[model samples]
Target chain A: MFFNLKDFIAEQSEGETDWEIDLSPLLALMVTLIPVLLLQTSFATLKMIETTLPVLSDAEQKPEEKKKDEIDFNLSLFANKKSELVMELVVDNKRLKSVTIKPDGEKFDFIKLQEELFAVKKKYPKENRLKLMPGDGVPYDIIVKLIDSSRVTPEKKPMRFVSSTGENLETTFLFPDVVFGNITN
Target chain B: MSIVHDIVKKAQKDSGFTLQLTAMVDMFTIMIVFLLKSYDTSTLEVKNVDGLVLPSSITAAAPEEAMLMLVSKKGVFLNDKRLASIVDNKIEAKSLAKEDEDFIEPLFKELNIEAEKIEAIAKRNSTVKFKGTIFMQADKGLDYSVLRKVMYTATMAGYGDLRLAALDGEK
Candidate 1:
């Protein structure tokens, strides 16, 4: 067989034209990014709650005569040091009852707090606003848990409410509107 | 006769080994899909700082782009810049009460600058509106007083809409 260098070069060039690009670098990049993205995936699940600072205004104060017939269902919760949770029910700017919840072992008794709040929810089905006034020393996690407890009834103990269609439905909406307030002792 | 038999046996053996990559490729494919699915691009970018573990919540709304303030046990930060140290879950009482008169000076200054910048941008661009919002990320262990001070400073700086950042609880 006669070896033709020109023809061999031409054939090699033609074969090169059909060659596939190496995707190994791209694959390596993807492999490297997967773990980084996985670590960052938690930020995607980040959530937020809209809160406003409690404003003090003279307009909020009204004469006692005007509010005689109006029943305010707003509940106030105070978490103090020594793991004590004080709950107060305010009706027409009057304190109805103040209940203090102590810790169960090493943790605050959230179940008891939920039960108390649930009772209030049952009494005032239309009232949804709650004021959580955490003491200066109370940790933020406890406040978040308190908010969680006040906002909804736990799944384990789902409350039953009659729907507009007259069908009884299990719901978790206890007090969705929460106003963060200063601890006024 | 023995040598000829050995040669025939050698000739009958398979030639080479082949590696199957189908299973590996499938694994990588699934991994890529899972990673992509878990990556959330809609939420605001948050970097984990030391001593700042976000509390978990069941809410699902994404945060808007706004001034970022981080309150941790170690210190208070505005957009990653340390403004003040937290002692006993409170910013230096002197600075808040007398020096700044119930306002965190550094945080207030930073937030005021940001609010003014946003206001300027809104003035030039008719479509842009200053929402006066701040995205606050505080450590789960921080006291409410610290959060209150930070939030109050932010509100005074004209960022009234406070969006508290938290981790999404497992549903």
Candidate 2:
């Protein structure tokens, strides 16, 4: 292909002829790269979608076994299902912020929440130390949506948890000092 | 020498000033085609047991594995099985979840069971890892306590990677 185009151009110059330049080679290059370029973009797009964590495959199931390992992080969230679109945030046993979603609105003010999350992410970028304890009967989808919404780009969002209330429950899982000194009595 | 003839000759010799945009246009056309191809496959919607609605987010990622545990507003579920909903002898899943306390005992038990099952499978095959990704599909109105409890349970279950489900524009 290269030799043909070189010769064609040379011949035109030698003949001093006003012939139209054939762009077939350039078009061919583009046509060849179409699939490769398409594949690259699609791969990235697919990667982001894949991270949403779909269901597990068969070759991946294991039977239940008990192990005594402490939780890596203690994190949670609070959603007010009684009212419309109201939610609160906590991190490392501390109340971070409480923001409200519009009644019957499809979205929440994530920009404000992102600020709160940024503060927490700045404090604990690698490990999640927050807990998410949601109220009863709040739409399950809303809770999931909140978790998805709380994430910040280029930063790790805190972990979430359901609320618990019992004296038998222990708060010494992570940063025991924070549980006792700041989050608990 | 005629002034117009001299000027015309000089202008014709100045070839550097002219640019052929045909090549540029070709490059742009190829780039546009690639960009369109690389765009993500629209978006996907997933549901839990109770039909609780979760807003999907653009940040929600696709994973190599598809082991998602759905925590609905009603109770804790895996693939939609009721695992635990009681907190201190309570049946409600929406009540104020205890905060800063060990609030994930019941939920963790269920998740740990599932994790062990996966681990056992991985052990048998020796080709897969038991580490499945978790997508937390929490409601928008969930309180801090309940949210925390759910988060704690997922982390304790040996699922370190987490994805929060939300609508795209919301974030």
- Candidate 2's C-alpha runs over 4 A off are A1-185, B1-45, B48-51, B56-59, B62-64, B86-101, B104-106
Calculate candidate 1's fnat: 0.56
Estimate, for each residue in B1-171, the C-alpha lDDT of model 2 and write its tens digit: 244334434554685332344775578686866677555444433453453555554444453445555555566666666666644323354332465353456666767787888888898898878765665555444444555555555655556555555544334
Best by TM-score: 1
Superposed model 1: Cα runs more than 4 Å off: A1-40, A55-71, A161-170, A183-185, B1-18, B59-61, B97-101
RMSD (CA, Å), each prediction? 10.4, 15.4
DockQ of 1: 0.27
Deviation in angstroms for B153 in model 2?
Answer: 2.4
* Candidate 2 residue-wise lDDT, A113-151, digit = tens: 555554544445444333434455554455444554454
**How far in Å is the alpha carbon of B119 misplaced in model 1?**
1.6
DockQ of each: 0.27, 0.14
- For model 2, state the Cα shift of residue B47 in Å: 0.9
Q: Assess each prediction's global lDDT (C-alpha) against the native.
A: 0.74, 0.49
